[model samples]
Target: MESRQRALVLHRLPYRETSLLLDLFTEQQGRIRLVALGARRRRSTLQGCLQVFTPLQIQWRGTGGTLQTLRQAEALSLSLPLTGRALYSALYINELLCRLLVPDVSYEALFGQYLQTLCQLAASDGQYEPILRCFEFALLQALGYGVDFQRCAATGTLVQDQVHYRYQAEYGFVTAAVASQDSFSGQQLRALAAGQLSDAATLRAAKIFSRLAFKPYLGARPLKSRELFY
Candidate 1:
């Protein structure tokens, strides 16, 4: 007998002759892959429910070592259809999760953030840059690489309105003078710290800053979805 689990379908691919391999982000078990037997056949029950970016309630049966088989599934909701840039951005988010997150690492907070981001993208008429940046920050924090933007990395003093600062990858932020050659701006840092997303200039700056921050984790492979937007 297999255990039942609630999961978010993160990614899926065709498997075998008529099956599907699903990469799922679950509530209790974190990420796992399951084989959906004969899911491609017409009228197959599992075919319609399993899709990227959708929430799913699923049950699978397998022991400790082998790939599990999906026994039952149901769609939780109708995911908002994202098109054009929004679609690309959604794919970018998925790519980030595929690359950075480790399977079976329980991160309920990060999962919540992911769901929130999708909802934001689905509804907002605003630019997606700010939404993506905010999610990036949240994801990093959940993964234990959160940056400290409240105080100067050099002086350890609380951030002040009149002072400029620079962000470094290894060190969070330092006084402008001490930041040496790092790339960042005091205004942008403050804006992010304050959680203001409506400012376009601040949003652009945050995007650049986050790109630099996430570089190490992304390795040499460029995110293909990014190209669709750029």
Candidate 2:
């Protein structure tokens, strides 16, 4: 059966002499790869619609395998005008989705969240941190690696506002005696739990927490987008 959905091009590369291979995140089909025949040719209309961060209505059909042939693609709206940090951050989000999300599965909510993240990034200047952090946390939760910030993993005790804690992957947060570079304050945890990153400290903590949380799944290979940040 043919599947049609709204998608965003996550990554694309030249295929053969004239085609393009695309990794796409679709609202109905999670992440999938497609071959856009003749997309690289000068007159191919797919060239314009098949771009990173462009919202597209795409159509495809295939049997049981990772690769499919893209039948059609059309831009749903003007591509979000991202530049500098926002552009890099958008790339980071695309890379994360391509890396961590399972192919051929449905991540309906996460797909919407991803689009919203891009919109938020495009609308702001340098305030991409909180937006990225929120999307990262959401992505983690959607991938079944969500860590609870409201309680201690060690004792299941409620996280206190005055204490500190450290994230232990797969295991949730554990209480820390004092704050350190590796530890997060209870207030930060609470703010994160509430999805309220109101201060610099909480934003900083969220970044560290997300990096630590993603380390295991992302393996040792550093994300290429991370390099763009520095």
Candidate 3:
């Protein structure tokens, strides 16, 4: 049977001197690998459509294994004009999905969310850290690894604005008597929980909290795209 769906180009690599191997994220089928034969030819029609962050309508039929051969790819939307920092952040989004998401499962909602994240990146300047933070938190939540910033895990009490707390990697936030580098104020945590990252303090703490929560799932290998930030 043939399958056709809207897809986002995640990653692409040269194949066999002429073809291109693509990692694509589909709306209904999740991540799939497909090879576009002769895609490197000077007159290839797939050239413009097969790019990272470009929305495409892809058609293919599966072989026996995990890979497939691309029959056709059509552009569904215009290219997102992301450059500089925003481009790197967009790539980071791709890296996260490629690393953490389970293959062959339908991540329909996450697919939409991913596209929205890219749009947000394209529209913002250098101040999109909060947008990325929110997307990261949302992605973690979608994957069932989300950390609760609303309540203290140890005491089960509502987080208060005046208190200081520390985020344990395995558990949720706990009130900290002695603040450390990783310790976050209760107000900041609450603001993060509310997705309010306009303030510098909350934005910084949100990044720290998100990075800590994501560290385990992403494994020890650092994301290569993060180097583009520096």
Candidate 4:
């Protein structure tokens, strides 16, 4: 049976001579690996459409295999021109999806969020933090490791803005008797939950939360794209 899906090109590598191996985040199929035969050739139309951060319509026919053969791919839009920090941020996004997402399982909501993140990165406005934090939050939720910034895991109550809360990597946020390295102000927590990145402190707290939230899945090595920012 033939499978047609809309996908975001995550990563692609040269396979043999003229062919390419692709990692795509698809709405219907999640993270899929497809072999694009002859895609690297000069005359192949897919060579232009197969680039990163471009919306693509892909058709493939396969099941019960580690890889699928791409039947066709059409570019729905032009490639996004993300430069400077935005480009690095976009690369980080791709790396995260490729590293964490389970193959062949559909995550439609995550896919939508990924597309939205790409759009924000393409803006070239240099406001990468807020968008990145939101996407990371959403990604964690979609992957079933959601952070409970708005609620206390122990008390099962709404987090208080005046209180201090400490984040436990295995657990969510809990009320803290004393502020420490892992603790953040409740106001900052609430602000982060609301996607409001107005203050310097809140941004700092969000950055800490991002590290804690992703620490479990990221393994020993640091994210390579993260280094590009500084």
Q: Cα-based RMSD of the predictions, in order? A: 2.4, 1.1, 1.6, 1.6
The number of clashing residue pairs in model 4 is 0
How many times do residue backbones clash in model 2?
A: 0
Tens-digit lDDT track for model 4 on 73-147? 998888887888888898999999999998998899999999988898887477788889889889899889987
Can you give the lDDT of residue 221 in candidate 2? Answer: 93
| Model 2 lDDT per residue over 53-114, tens place | 88999999884365899999999998999999999999999999989999888999999999
The 10 consecutive residues of candidate 2 with the worst lDDT sum are 59-68
Q: Which ten residues in a row have the lowest lDDT in candidate 1?
A: 178-187
| Candidates ranked by TM-score | 2, 3, 4, 1
| Model 3 C-alpha lDDT per residue in residues 1-230, reported as the tens digit of each score | 68899999899999998899988899998888899999998899998889998889999888435678899999988999999889999999899988987777778888999999899899996788988998898788878888778899999999988888988777889999987778888888888888998988888898889888988888899999999888
TM-score of each: 0.88, 0.97, 0.94, 0.93
Prediction-by-prediction clash tally: 1, 0, 0, 0
**TM-score: model 4 vs. ground truth:** 0.93
For candidate 4, what is the lDDT? 0.88
Residues 60-94 of candidate 1: C-alpha lDDT, one tens digit per residue: 88754568889999888976677777878888998
Off by over 4 Å in 1: 63-66, 160-164, 176-182
Q: Estimate the TM-score for candidate 2.
A: 0.97
Best candidate (score: lDDT): 2
Candidate number that wins on lDDT, 1 or 3? 3
Pairs that clash in candidate 1 = 2-61
**Stretches of model 3 off by over 4 angstroms after superposition:** 63-65
